[model samples]
Target: MSEENQNQKAMPASLASVAAKHAQKQPGTNPLGTGLEARGVHAWFGTKHVLSDVTLDFAAGTVTALIGPSGCGKSTFIRTLNRMHEFIPTAALAGEVRLDGKDIYAPGTDVTKIRLKIGMVFQKPNPFPSMTIGENVLSGLKLAELKRSNTDDLLESCLVRAGLWNEVKDRLKEQGGSLSGGQQQRLCIARSLAVEPQVLLMDEPCSALDPGSTFRIEETIAELSQTMTIIIVTHNMQQAARVSDYTAFFLSNDGPGLMVETGPTSQIFSAPRDKRTEDYVTGRFG
Candidate 1:
């Protein structure tokens, strides 16, 4: 395929009309400002037990960074919070993930609704390659079957929240893939925000970006944390220390991944109570 054709294939198509019919109805009210809690969470992929007895609380309006070595279940634990782990045929989780004291895993709970309340941004910028910039921002609302009276307003607000409004406002109809890598990632973030989620999960959202893009994403994260709970999985300890209010350290060696310690970001980096955490943060060991 030609480079232009490949680029076109990379950008998701417009979903404005679909979004208009079912855009996010509630845009003004902040649905998120509530804390999230995980209790005794354990996870398995097929027959391989990956995480064990993990528990943590992400306070409302705070950024919590999950840090550890590779293969330590940081991403697995993040997925479990929004129930994304269950997408795997053999994946299983045993624990309670609570949002504002309500158990998300309770019997009869709607998984779709749970996901809407908890939005996720993956490690790579996966904006719908066929969608326009504006359409990409409103795609989540369409998926959630929500309708808003003002889609234009919703698009602009979400893009602004993601720090992409000024840069892309003039090209709302442009393909999402037309933007730079940093812009595409921000567009993904804008798409997530359009759903009005209470908790946002980011699994290494900046891993694919250059340093400049990483800085912009970090800025966006800082801004978003003012109104929503954020849980991020990152291997960059410095990034964790720079952007997170609280940090949790995960480890795996002889057994399943486990939480070694969690505390304020400053405390965890400056004076970790656990030797494992100390070693990881100090670059002595991962």
Candidate 2:
């Protein structure tokens, strides 16, 4: 057997259990967790093209990591998935972004609804300072006009799913910003979960965190992948290999960012097909 396959076989018993438990829950008819596809996608800020003809598929209930050096357009491409790129006044894109086979950018599509289905967690921990922890979790639901009879249960469940409930269960009323940086990031995750989004977009979610906190957030990602499609952009290759099922390597030279290769995580790390991908993975270059 391949070295990568052997290593995967030797994963810790606990982690294997976590993967087994949550991995089979497909997206079903729910638009939130459905598979996503980008076909011949190109993006530009005014006339400056940043991403060119990027075609990718993100399987439902799996984690796909976008990894590369800085200025490679990894972040920009992720933002485009949920239509966040449009927030930039000069930004525009071509090609199709499909959610469960339906084009999200089609005429008459509601941007707000698209965002609700695909939630984002930023690189830094951003919990609203003005709101309590409980309030923050419920904030998305409230904004979406989603009324649940069991608000308290919803809050607790989301927090629990985020792996933060035990830490802050008794202090839900505390200001969200009062928590430590790690706790705050988890809080942001809980807020995203409360909205029950199908796909979660994380842009270097652990970059600003310390080692211990980064580990915790990684655990949350693994657990959450069972229920939603997760696309993460990270410069840390180790984290990408550890958490993602699939990996895409993006590269940019004098022109727009382009995908060098993508495949199963084990294959990408063990035997990358492209020389550029091999160089980046082997620490030969960025």
Candidate 3:
């Protein structure tokens, strides 16, 4: 057998078209605003370049999945969108991440407001152990000093959107730490929803979860996408296919990670334009 034959693996059927047809039919425009846009984005830590020239359009009310191998800079790219990357002492970045047609990195922009419009849910569940489940959901409001009437309604709405309301509604006074890991993650998501962000960034939200938990998270993601833009970094191709409207593939070749290809989820899974993407989706290489 030759090397070419050895490299060929069975291609996955078009899971996106079959599993995420509803996502594809979602309205591309959110009544809130145009989607977030990234152009010529790059990132570095001290002298080591991590990401290079990533440009993507995340339409409002849609889910875009960043699919790539570990260390391809998927998480770093999303961090830059909301200025979280600046928190790193040695982190450096270039290019523009625009929201509502304005550059987020513009001088004197309110960092807090940017974050309010673009929220993040991390890989690990980090609900505040000291706070009760209900308090944890509404913590953002107090921390941001934004006042609202009827706290109970907001708590229930956020929890409902996060798909954890039924299970935790009776347990609202209980500490967030008391919940299982899956419930804790959903609680963290509910916490993010309290402020009502227009865009949400999820960095491998389901990576640490079991199958049942992962399915619940995916369901939450689908519901969330109907109102706001969502960008998720996922290594699970099936999840990406099942949840995202669009998919971006990233890779690194002895240098900075680059966006290899991006397209509608169905097309990316069925007929990727780049060989590298096909190779990765076919399990020939990362």
Q: Give the number of the best model, judged by lDDT.
A: 3
Over 4 Å off, model 1: 1-34
User: lDDT of all the models against the reference?
Assistant: 0.84, 0.87, 0.89
Where does the lowest 10-residue lDDT sum fall in candidate 1?
Answer: 16-25
Candidate 2 Cα outliers beyond 4 Å, as residue runs: 1-34
> Each candidate: RMSD to true structure?
13.8, 4.5, 3.7
- Residue-wise C-alpha lDDT for candidate 1, range 1-286, written one tens digit per residue: 3854443333222211221222121222444544899999999988899999999988777788899999999999999998999998999999999988999999999999999989999998998988888889999888888989998988899999999999998999999999999999999999999989988999999999999999999889988877888899998776786778788999999689999999877656655678677667767877
- Please report the candidate that would top TM-score against the real structure: 3
Question: Could you tell me how far off, in angstroms, the CA of residue 193 lies in candidate 1 after the best superposition?
Answer: 0.3
For 1-286, candidate 2 gives per-residue lDDT tens digits of 5864664454443433432333333334334545999999999999999999999999888889899999998999999999999999999999999998999999999999999999999999998889999999999987899878999999889998999999999998899988999999999999999988889999999999999999999999988987899999999888887788888999999799998899877666766678788778777878
Clashes of 2: 2
Ranking by TM-score: 3, 2, 1
Worst 10 residues of 2 by lDDT: 18-27
Number of backbone collisions per candidate, in order? 10, 2, 0
TM-score of each: 0.88, 0.89, 0.94
lDDT of 2: 0.87
Which one wins by lDDT: 1 or 2? 2
- Per-residue lDDT of 228 in model 1: 88
Compared to the true structure, candidate 1 yields what TM-score?
0.88
